[model samples]
Target: MRETREKVQLQPLDHDLAFLDITTEWDLSSSYHDWRPSIAVPATFVPATIPRVIAICNQKGGAGKTTTALELALALIARGLRVRIVDVDDQEASISVWLRYYMDDRPEELRYNLRDLYFNAKVKLSEASYPTDFENLTFIPSFPDLGEVDEKNPVGADTCLQRRLRQGADDVDVTIIDCGPRLGQLTVSALVAADDVIIPVKASSILDMKGVAALQKVVNVVKDTLNPDLRIAAAVLTDFSRSKMTRRIGGSLARAYPDAVILPARTNVKVGEAQLAQQPLRQFAPRETTTLDYDLGARVLFGLGAAA
Candidate 1:
């Protein structure tokens, strides 16, 4: 058998394959600089049998929602599943901008986007779902103007995304929606659209943990009034390295969402370079330890491997 590298064993909330720990050590043995071991993934596990609509959500900005969404989607695609990713956040920093390889810099130059699907009924979901460089992965870009939906609060605004995605993304095995920070119509729309919500929090910030309260409040309201089946599926602690604070956050997430998976996405500074290049970390920096974290996260969530 191969020698083991893990310093500590992490127990998942359940028997499912999920990465609950976020800490890793730097490789002292290597000539190169690398985060040594990825959080353990199980040797075997049953993956999801049906398609999933997962929303990457967090009310706190810079908490890693976009990173989780795009990286997880890429990981799923790498597993040979057809994936459709929707960038619902309209900010310049969102996936809508980072994922502009197939899209024009000028939002108006694009044929279709969130502005078309959400603001105007004439545009169909398929029209906005664009093909990406990857074979099995598709992209749906959102522009700055689309943020108006939060302000306009159009008729059936909350349910509109669910309806569109259900109708448009039916061909894909997984659909990941990257949500903007803040509780409002846009976030509500994503929650309403998703069957599962994956919340990303900064491991170092207790303030980010506090933001979950507001998100959970909104989620409770969504469950009561709209999508009763909606669930908080996972809490991903990003920028994670082992520390007293990270362990505390992980434990707190575990206690709060007893039935949900808690994962740590170990930090990689190369993430920004990947984003600037407008490529998923899987493609840009496949060897990066943090990319491995997202890959293992995808497998764990989908049951692609056994729990470690």
Candidate 2:
């Protein structure tokens, strides 16, 4: 059967960049028709090592949570470490979409495999794995059905992932969980399962204070009730612009959370554009400003330069 071709113009933000998709019978082809061709380099040529899991979470929406998750996942994978992501947001499957486009725009030789893990109380982690184009990266995707699981199982819902983390999550070096915008049962489960958390705070807004407060509350609760080892490894600053107010909040947050690292604020359009195409910033614009920010953030969290 022949299928009709439809023009899909994807513009993630109000930028001068876009992507075109051509669909044919049993086939699809795409290219960066509007974007400039940029080559991405491997992540610092690190030796073979075990991966680690970091959860990029914040209660405030529009804080670039998923972008942080996917960008870091792709950056780490490019560095030759095996990485996987668990997307816990059922309402907005943003990471899931990015992985799909990432798989699409590849040379078939250097593509990383991405997978998704949906919320299933009864299903084991072994059953949720899916293969992607990238070699070192896999994803556990979340869907709307996850909302059902969240609603039906209230008490034990948050504990499900904790059980899976114990039973599984040791195969790879890193498992990054992109959490929802609010403190729900799923967020609780991710905290219980995670060894560390990466909170991205958008600077220049008092609105972020609420997220910080909520995050701190959860951390205290989890440290007391659940996993004592759970630490606030880093609180990254995102979407930061150059101004006195920006520097003020950035400095304040760094002081308030002295243990956490406050990396520089990167305002890159390529990051948003990649998200619109469901692609990672590294894959779309590797040398772009956003990718550079992610690289630095990864280094700090991974403790590459800091004294050990």
Candidate 3:
């Protein structure tokens, strides 16, 4: 038995299989800096089974919509799925800044801005795609000029994004769009193209609840008029704290939208830290509670597990 145990311990550990097993105790002895696990693509992995387009949207700013979009994309990539992020938010171009920050620190020629595609009508979607350091992950960087798309083509601006993704990004397993905090042409374009929408709400604010109601009204209107296939997949709470007020607000939100899935609040400082470092949570602090929250949230979003 001792010899058999020694032989088993001598076997090489598979580096590609890095999924969270809630039942197993994590080994903390290993260096956290060296903990990034490669995704092991299964032979049976199918692209058709997953939702093709997901828009992380909220009409209200500071509601963690951008963070949710970024983390969810990372989690999906970690699951051995190919993902492309479309940064449609032109105000801050937060995702674009993150991508630039990442590329500036590294030495790679795979970088292209979204403006190249948005400004030129003849540019193919695949032509604008840029590779990231993460395997199976790519993004179309946004620019401030993206906000002017509405002015440039007022008649068909609402469908510009939809047409672009359909023409160029058909090969990706999933495309996640980070929308600006408003229900304008850009947001409408995203909703029209999305197969599912994930709304991130801050749990402690009553105004956020009102924002959700307003956003839902727009979503319903879009569904009835433009996109019959779009649906509100989930509303996740961000920057949540375990307080009486938060619990009260969360309960109210649950009761208000019974059909919608309300996810647990993801309260962690590492989320901000990762963003500051221009790295995904999985790459910056994989074992942190925030990373785990993103993993659980992704599972729920993709129907991999029960809603948390």
What TM-score, computed on C-alpha atoms, does each candidate reach? 0.82, 0.74, 0.77
lDDT, residue 277, model 1 = 79
Model 3, range 1-308, lDDT digits (tens) per residue? 11211110111112233333321111223454543221111222222246489988888888988788887887777666788998887776478777644434334433445655556676678766766666677788777777676566555666777888888555788999988887877788889989888888886777788888888888888899889978766667788665556555555655555444556545778877887887766667766765666676576556565222
lDDT of 1 by residue, 168-276 (tens): 6558999899988868898898899888988899999998987898899999999999999888777888998866667667777766776666677887789888877
lDDT score at residue 170, model 2, on the 0-100 scale = 72
**Candidate 1 vs 2: which has more lDDT:** 1
TM-score of 3: 0.77
Candidate 3 stretches greater than 4 Å from native: 1-51, 101-112, 115-119, 306-308
Q: Sort by lDDT, best first: what order? A: 1, 3, 2
Query: Which 10 residues in a row give candidate 2 its minimum summed lDDT?
Result: 19-28
Which ranges in model 1 have alpha carbons more than 4 Å from their true place? Answer: 1-49, 104-110, 306-308
In order, candidate lDDTs are 0.75, 0.61, 0.67
Residue 69, model 3, lDDT: 84
